[model samples]
Target chain A: MSEERTEINSLGEFGLIELLTKNIEIQQASTILGVGDDAAVIDHFGRQTVISTDMLVEGIHFDLMYTPLKHLGYKSVVVNLSDIYAMNATPTQITMSIAFSNRFSVDALNEFYEGVYAACEKYGVDLIGGDTTSSQKGFVISVTAIGEVAPDKFVKRSTAEKGDLLCVSGDLGAAYLGLTLLEREKQIYLESPQLQPDLENQTYIIGRQLKPEARRDIIEFLQEQDIQPTAMMDVSDGLSSEILHICKQSNLGVVLYEEKIPIANETKEMALKFSLDPTAAALSGGEDYELLFTMKQADYDKIVLSEQISVIGYMTDISEGAHILTKGGNKFKLVAQGWNAFQQ
Target chain B: MSEERTEINSLGEFGLIELLTKNIEIQQASTILGVGDDAAVIDHFGRQTVISTDMLVEGIHFDLMYTPLKHLGYKSVVVNLSDIYAMNATPTQITMSIAFSNRFSVDALNEFYEGVYAACEKYGVDLIGGDTTSSQKGFVISVTAIGEVAPDKFVKRSTAEKGDLLCVSGDLGAAYLGLTLLEREKQIYLESPQLQPDLENQTYIIGRQLKPEARRDIIEFLQEQDIQPTAMMDVSDGLSSEILHICKQSNLGVVLYEEKIPIANETKEMALKFSLDPTAAALSGGEDYELLFTMKQADYDKIVLSEQISVIGYMTDISEGAHILTKGGNKFKLVAQGWNAFQQ
Candidate 1:
């Protein structure tokens, strides 16, 4: 990084926002107005709009010691977009509000916006209105995503039927394993400044943690294949926890098979290296940003043709309760041991 | 003010969210689904949707020493609603995301939500969605408001003409005075515990600061009177600064009269008590969530009929520049010393 530091106070809040958003091009036809104004205007004439919000606090959601600011910006946008995709909606616009202390310079903010712009370019979403202010301590980010879906195509998490088959896109546990590796490396670097991080060998898992992508492609594929999920959500708080959320909301029970859970080979190896159970890691590890849904059994044939998806379970009557069947022929109740920031 | 305190960790994140949002009745016909889903869905079929977001950090935007949690919650939501009304739109829904340290308890959160619920009821807007998580330090709030306006009825800050008359709703500078009084009381209390705050005579100004309301009524009155503003914005950052924004965006200039500025008698007295200029306070002191707008000269008669409205200025040619005409007939260029959070 170059040492050319520019004080944020030199340019006022409005100046900084204008500088950052100057090159943002509106690609969504629904967005009638963006940035520059008191509020953004959108005209989604025939489609229903979906809205979701998320906040990430420094030291709570991420550590600056191990995470790059650019990656942080990208991941922040991706996380909010995941919620939109979880509703089977195509994200059209986002408003990003950030507060940072004076410890950061203007160049540092430029790098963060570069990542934000890159994400906007990749997703073809417009950057709308936002508030930029100062924080008393570390950095804080809040993002709100707006999306559009056909009136009859929007999905909810409380409409799954008892005979629906549970499905998830992409492999699980990699992001959590990646987080463990990064935390370990951060500890080693803190103890001895001369030791460089041995991150080359763990590139895949590290990328999973640092740059997880929202499954917009999955939503598109489901639409192309004419498959409408009965209930859907993103695997942000782990597969087991998300499954339990769907079942509880739908007033049904579920039976998940341990062997059917898809854990990447690299993630499984890393879990064992840390002396952790691979199955448990896949079940309870969070932040994968993958789509998890329940579809009718009749739609199973259409989904099985896609290699990116895995069928892990099936919904059952409410009397059966929620449980996981082990490969060794044992059944245990599934509990939500997902990561909670307030646990300490 | 209750002595009952329940630890947040005992109920977990999901339980706490459920408890907070269980009774959030959806009042807007546009809101299809709320709270329980991954994203809330709204159907604004023929109307143009307006979106705005604002973030309030604990120590930066407000001080907890004199700010009740309930009042803080109410003010946060009102500030965002003010932006929606600035666009000549009727706010329909809001998403409130908050982060706080564990020093807060469930009872404290309930108090905050009570205020949020009160604002929703008063505005007839639905609480559609939000994210609640832990912060490492003080409290943080991010609120996003969504509103709707007719396709051609929405106002912008860049549409004023040279002959338009400048108008303002309600008196200004009172919120800043209220803040000064609160800070003084806090200082006195810090010096001697036995010194009780003498706030009995400062009720009006203090209330203006702590519980500022968005001018939804002004928007309604304009619609009812068949009057549309050529340009409009909210006075969150004081009159002079907002006037400069309108002039710059609209490629015009303005001439504001000092004698015409609407400073309340209570605010003038409070400013004199603190040895501050009342006109300067009205010009630069911020946080007065009033509406500043421009209308055709022909509409002046209709606006003056309402006691709440004031005609303060008029738009001029671009070469004239923005200036304030003093009561003594002296003219001075209006510089935006508006509240810049980045300035030390």
Candidate 2:
């Protein structure tokens, strides 16, 4: 990246906004107006809109010491899009609001927006209107994603019934292991400024952490297969915690099989190298951005045709409780050991 | 007000979110789902949706020393709704995402939510979804307001004709004067802790500053009167700057009458007490949250029936330039002195 620094102060707030949003290309026919107005108008044309928001703060969410601005920007958007996909909706538009201190330059912001636009284009979502201002402290990002779905077609977390097959898309626990590796490298670099960090042969894990993509393909594939999920949510706060949410909200119980949990080869290798259990990481780790859903037993034959998905468990009655059977046939109650950001 | 503090950590992120949102009552018929889902679903029933977002950072956009959490929360929602209303639409839902450091208590956040729900009820909008997390520093707020309008009924800022009549709702600069007075009091309070600052008979201006209301009534009245604005926007950045935006975006100029600029009596007196120009304050001060709009000149007679609105100017061809004619017959160029949050 060029070290060409352009002071944000040189351009006023409006000027900076103009500079950033000048290249916005509207891809959605629903987008009647994009930026430059008080608001953006979208006509979904009878499709119900799905909306979700997320806020990412500096230090709390990401450490700039190891995170690139572009990747952070990309991850920021991908996280919100994941929520829309979790609802089984096709994301069509997004609004990105950001606040930064003087610590960031216009070029840095441009880099961030470049990644934002890249993700927007890939997801086929139009970047609509948003607010940009200066923060007195850390960089802050808030994104609101808008997706469209047919009326009564959206999925929820409380719709699963008894005997539904629990499924998740792709592999998990990679992003958490990736974060651990990056933090380790950052500590080494901090202790010895002259030493170059070792991060070879970990591109998949690092990419999972830095530029995690939302499971748009999973959503599309499920729709194309005519498999409507009884309950669905993204694996953002780990598989165990998310399954617990499904059971709790739907007033049902789940019997998860430990052996069936999907863990990538890279994730398992890294977890073991770090003296951690790969199964524990897969069940408790977060930020995988994979799709976790439950479907009727009738879709079993059709689901097996897709290699990208795994049937990890089945929903049981409330009396059975939410539990996971280990490889030794020992059942343990599933607890939400998910990341509690407020925890000390 | 209660000192029985509850640490946000005691209840984890999910717990706190449940506690905060457990009482949300869905009010919109278009809303298919509210909180607790991966994403909120809303069916506009064929109405176009207008969406706008705004991010407010602590110490830059607001000072918490004198800002009550409730008013801050109320103001946050109102400010975003003002934008939706600016589009000639009826606000239906909002998503609020807030991040705060350990400095904030659960009680404080509850106070803020109290104001948020109050504003939601008053505006007949639903709090459909939001994100809350612990920040590493001061509180950060981002709100996305969503509204519904009939097909092709939403107004824009660039559609005003050359001879459109310019109008604004309510008085201006009171909020600016109120901010000036409070800031002065804050300074005095810091310098002399024993002396209680004098703020008697300034409730109007103070309320305008601390708890500004969106011009919902103005939008309703315009709709009831069957008046469609050619162009409209909320005066968030000051009268002069907003008119300049209208002229620039519409590819037209404007002639604003200084004498017609509506500054309240209390605001004028307060400006005089501070040795400031009332007109200048009205022209440059921001956060008024009033509607500045342009309509067909033929609706002048009908618009005058409403005492809340004042016709201040008329649009002109680009050759005429944007200027304000003073009471003394001198014309001056209208420049943007709007609050640039990035300035040192």
Candidate 3:
């Protein structure tokens, strides 16, 4: 490095990626798109190839004190699958690379792979290749998932039209509440070694947080419904943040209904128990791993209202603000305050 | 995760990977091969696709005390590229991800990517996609490289025959000696904070360790020579270890002569300085990133007398012990004591 030093926070994660990669130009004819999108696309044989990656860091992403290695492994695969799902494609293969501190016993790693295997089995995705290395500190996982879809069916976040219905897969905020419960129990156990976690009533919330499933089923459901989403992305960073991404990319605004936002009863109770607003958790709390997509209103009724998919809002002209209408009919502008690991 | 506790050491790295993934069955028809080769192959459209991954962790892989961030980033990508080269494929795309502790400044990461960008430019590879996450420990890099080769051109480690010539790319042991010099200087600096390293004379060796290059050039040169290697692997884990992999897989043996082994002059001098056997370092040193391959004897005249490729030995039937003809004219069984991060 030069004698001059600059803090990482001076240029946030996205800013750093842009600065470092500004000179990068795609050289391969196979690389149809690079560096920007829900995933990279390589034109293969005849169909389009989709590739996406995600990395999970210990301590920053999870507290292994309460997070099981199996769930961590499973979640690592699911998060990448979620990115593939965001592109409206089914993941066929994934490569996982793990960096582990020796503090973790070999058995711990076995258990971790056991969970990865389980997710692979459930999703019908192949565990193709990976690297195993030793970290100087906590655990780290990076997975690159590859999938294929017809070039026409692939959804990009830059194509939402005005008046398109903003649909979401399943409920949100449950995972965030689950994490809060786990953290609380971890602290309680830390203070009193013999204290057992009273997690009897929070199974749904805790399960959502620990072993959240990717919305692969939604992809199949959309296929059956014959509705191609105009714009789509995974709700890993809360609905508000994802909505802003779609709006910013597609150059549109949205109007969301607070009453229409999906939140399970279990999540609401957990939020109340923690003395937190359920809506706030659903809006800004992340890691839901649900599909947030937009489709033309003409196809709304075609998507049979099931427990899994819900219509929460609709896209609007750019002049209209991206706002949330409360149950009391008051509108508030939406702004993103989602997780930013580089902020500190 | 059950009440049972098992040791991962009992399984070893490969064994652990096998046991954990034994139950995973590929369900996607596009996935042609998985988990058993240097890279995974997926049938896309009409073309066969290849993907490989590798991860590097600080302390276990490199000591940042003497290593520069730029070189670390470059080596991380080079290491992954070696896997592609091992398969006799040319890498065209890469996804680079990093997890770093707050100790790393934005400028430091920029320098790191500067190295990565340099390698990409040198190799004609594209940076397609990646993830950025926060690590609570030292820096970690995980790279996934995708490449394409005519299905028939790809080589495996299990294809060498009895009469094939064993060829290695460039020289060996230089990287191993380079690491020794860097470690010695690091200890000196630790003892006396103001001590500047006497690094002028050790640049070649130290540079090999700090900024090793993958022999992608050899792949291109071999193609030009019209000599396809029967079996090949990158010498990341020492010549003895890699040769053993081919022997165990192809059921063959090899006879190597110490006098014929290539060692750089600087490396030999550094070995004597450290009171280490230069030949021993050449035999077992890891991270040289040289290609160890076997070719048909008919192609001997084409590869020999070339400055870039060296004919080191020849393959034999399995009954013949894999032996090394020492400078003293005594044949000794080759020992495999390759680098092991866990044991470190």
| Listed models, DockQ each | 0.17, 0.17, 0.73
Models 1 onward score TM values of 0.86, 0.86, 0.94
- Model 1, range A297-316, lDDT digits (tens) per residue? 99988988798899999999
Clashing residue pairs, backbone N/CA/C < 3 A, model 2? none
Best-first order by lDDT: 3, 2, 1
Candidate 2 or 3, higher lDDT? 3
Off by over 4 Å in 3: A1-5, A338-344, B1-12, B22-24, B338-344
What's the number of clashes in each of the models?
0, 0, 1
In model 3 chain A, the worst 10-residue window by lDDT is A335-344
Check candidate 3 and list the clashing pairs.
Answer: A45-B46
| Model 3: residue B101 alpha-carbon error in angstroms | 1.0
State in Å the error of residue A248, model 1.
Answer: 0.3
lDDT of 3 by residue, B1-344 (tens): 58766665666676767776677788888887688677887887566788999888888888888888889889888988888898898898999988888898887888899899888888889999997778888888889999887767888888999989988998899999988888888888889989888875878998899899989889988999998999988898777778888887789988987788889998888889888888778778888999999999999898776898888888999999687777788777776762231123
Candidate closer to the true structure by lDDT (higher is better), 1 or 2:
2
In candidate 1, what are the lDDT values of residues B1-344, reduced to their tens digit?
75544554445433544543443444445544344311233446767777888899999889989998889888988998898898898787777888887777654666677677778778877666677777889999999988777866778888999989999999999999999999999999999979888885888899999999999989999998889999998998888888988998799999988899999999999999999888878888899999999999998878878978899999999999988888888778887863331122
Worst 10 residues of 1 chain B by lDDT: B32-41
DockQ score, prediction 1: 0.17
Find the 10 residues in a row with the least total lDDT in model 1 chain A.
Answer: A32-41
> For model 2, how does the per-residue alpha-carbon lDDT over A1-344 read when each residue is reduced to its tens digit?
75655554455333544554444444434444344321233446656677888899999889999899999988998999998898888777777888887666555666787788778778877666576677888899999988777766778888899999999999989999999999999999999989998996799999999999999999889888899999898988788888987998799999988889989999989998999878778888899999999999999998797889999999999999988888888778887772331121
